[model samples]
Target: MINFTLDQWYGWINAFLWPFARLLAMFSVAPVFGESTAPSIPKVGLAAVIAMVVAPTLPPFPALATSSYEGLLVLAQQVFIGMALGFVIRICFSAVQTAGDFVGLQMGLSLATLYDPSTHSNTEVLARLFNILAMLVFLVFNGHLLMLDVLIRSFTALPIGHASLNPAAWMGLAELGGKIFSSGLLLALPLIAALLTLNISLGILNRAAPQLSAFSVGFPIMLISGVLLLTVVLPHTPSYLNEFYQEMLGHMARIADTFAAPRGGAN
Candidate 1:
């Protein structure tokens, strides 16, 4: 049997535990990995596997005993940092879904909804479709790998338990809330403009001919127009989404920077 002191055992445990906490928090909130339909065993197992892989590169944890108050604080900090990172990614996907919802509404498909098992909520059909497209692009282009890269770089950028999340960082996260709307609106604008014009023309026609059934005529036009408009938009999503993905991750890096240790500072 190998001789190991209590401190040695604790150090070994610390090496794994802290990274695992952060990875678990990340997967709990990160896109794709966080979906409710994702099996818990695999998710946790993946986090554990990654934590093990990254463990050797981690800066040394504080010398304080694992059971100490400081250790608990460090654990919490890891969770917060992981969550902050994951939330940024989640926002990007949400924006895509929002854009789809806007298009669906314009197409008079608002009533066509589906149960989203991932969120335990009802989402418009087109919104789900857009989300699936966005997700596929994310996977095809290895965007999720980029997210993992960010998480790994974060250990260097933010370090383990080196700094506390401040009010400003939290505020920065809140700002992403508005970003969802702006980006979503940008994606949906062309379709919206087209549909709005169609609706207005239909309205004038209805006024000119009272016998014209605007409901019957308007619905078909909007349906066909929406489908055509989406076809135009869908092909371009990958490029636009790529730009948005980079922008979102860039913000996350900056957030990590806020917590970075001063150059050459003692661990």
Candidate 2:
């Protein structure tokens, strides 16, 4: 008969639980896994499954009781690490949404809003459309699988109980968030420039003929021209979104670098 002491049982239980906690924290907030529309129970189940698979192979886990003070601190650190990793990907996905927002505003479609289950709030229609497209592209690139690979590898790069996150790395995340405005502007640039020139021409025409209501006539023309310009630009958006995704993954690794241990694995 195999005899297991109380401490060994505790260690075994905790080994599975600790990494499970981190996985939950991550998937709960990370993109499609965390989308407001997704039910919570499935996310928990998925995390549990991954933990079971991953726990056995992990290096010896710290024997910290889930209820103790030290254990609480460790739990908090794991959550922090999870949020940091998930947020990096969220920032990347936001780039497309940001671009769509600019295009919508320029096209006078700002008033067209939809209830976005992903956010549980009203979002611009164009942003939502772009979000759908980005999702499709993400799947095409096998990003979901890549994310799972990264999660497993993170144990090696940022093993349990060895958490020590550097604060300086947050600056990098802030910079990532800031990319929304600049990149969005770049995405919408062709339309914005074209619209500006159109508006100028309309202004000159209005000056030449005061009787015609320039506002009424220019609105339809701008709308039509914006549609044309959007069609012209649509072909190029996939490449831009692809590049942004790559950048997001790079930054994700960099931000976590502050907290991750030096270990070799899929990340």
Candidate 3:
């Protein structure tokens, strides 16, 4: 029978535990992997499997007792880093959903919402539809694999440590939140402009002849027009989403670099 010293056992545990913590935290929030309908067992199992694969490759990390204060801090840092990375990617999806919200509102479909199990909230039909399409695109493009690649690279970019993260890194993350509106607005602008023009034309017609009942016909017109526009727009989305994912991947790299830099130092 093989025997191991206490230190050897601790080394083995440390090798797996830290990486597992980070992967588990990431999978808890990252898109596709984080879906609520997915059972937690698989997420945990996947995290474990990845940690095992990654542990041997990790650079030598500080060996501290798991119960030690510094060890706890390191664990927390891993969790925070993982969550930040996941949140940045999640923002990409949020932008797409926001664009759908804009188009749905313009098409008078804002009220047509359904219970979204993934989000655990009532979501507009168009918004949900867009999210589904985006998910499909993400899968088709192997985005999930890319995301995992980024996560693995982050370990090298921001190694396991007790280093105090720069405040600027957190600030940068907060600022990144603005992408939801800016990107969303851009994506939805074409549809919004078309629908707005339709609404304006209907309003002018109603003013010219009240008997035309433009108000009565406007809903159907907007709905049908919106559907037609989506058919045109949907085909073009993969390219935009590809660019969007690339941009977020850049952000993830920056974040990891920033977090690894010493506090108050240039990253």
Q: Which candidate is the best by TM-score?
A: 3
Worst 10 residues of 3 by lDDT: 160-169
Q: Highest lDDT: which candidate?
A: 3
Instruction: List the candidate 3 regions with Cα displacement exceeding 4 Å.
Output: none
Candidate 3 per-residue C-alpha lDDT over 17-39 given as tens digits, one digit per residue, 9 for 90 to 100: 99999999989888899989889
Which of 2 and 3 is the better model by TM-score?
3
- Per residue, candidate 1 scores C-alpha lDDT tens digits across 1-267 of 879898887788888989999899989998899999899999999999999999999887776567889888988888988998899999998998999999999899999999999889999999999899988988887889999999998988777868555556666788888878899999889889999999999999999998999998899899998898888878988998888999988987876775553543322
Location of the lowest summed lDDT over 10 successive residues in candidate 2: 258-267
Q: Which candidate do you rate higher for TM-score, 1 or 2? A: 1
Model 2: lDDT of residue 57: 91
lDDT score at residue 266, model 1, on the 0-100 scale: 21
Candidates' TM-scores? 0.94, 0.90, 0.97
* Lowest summed lDDT window (length 10), candidate 1: 258-267
Error of 3 at 99 (Å): 0.6
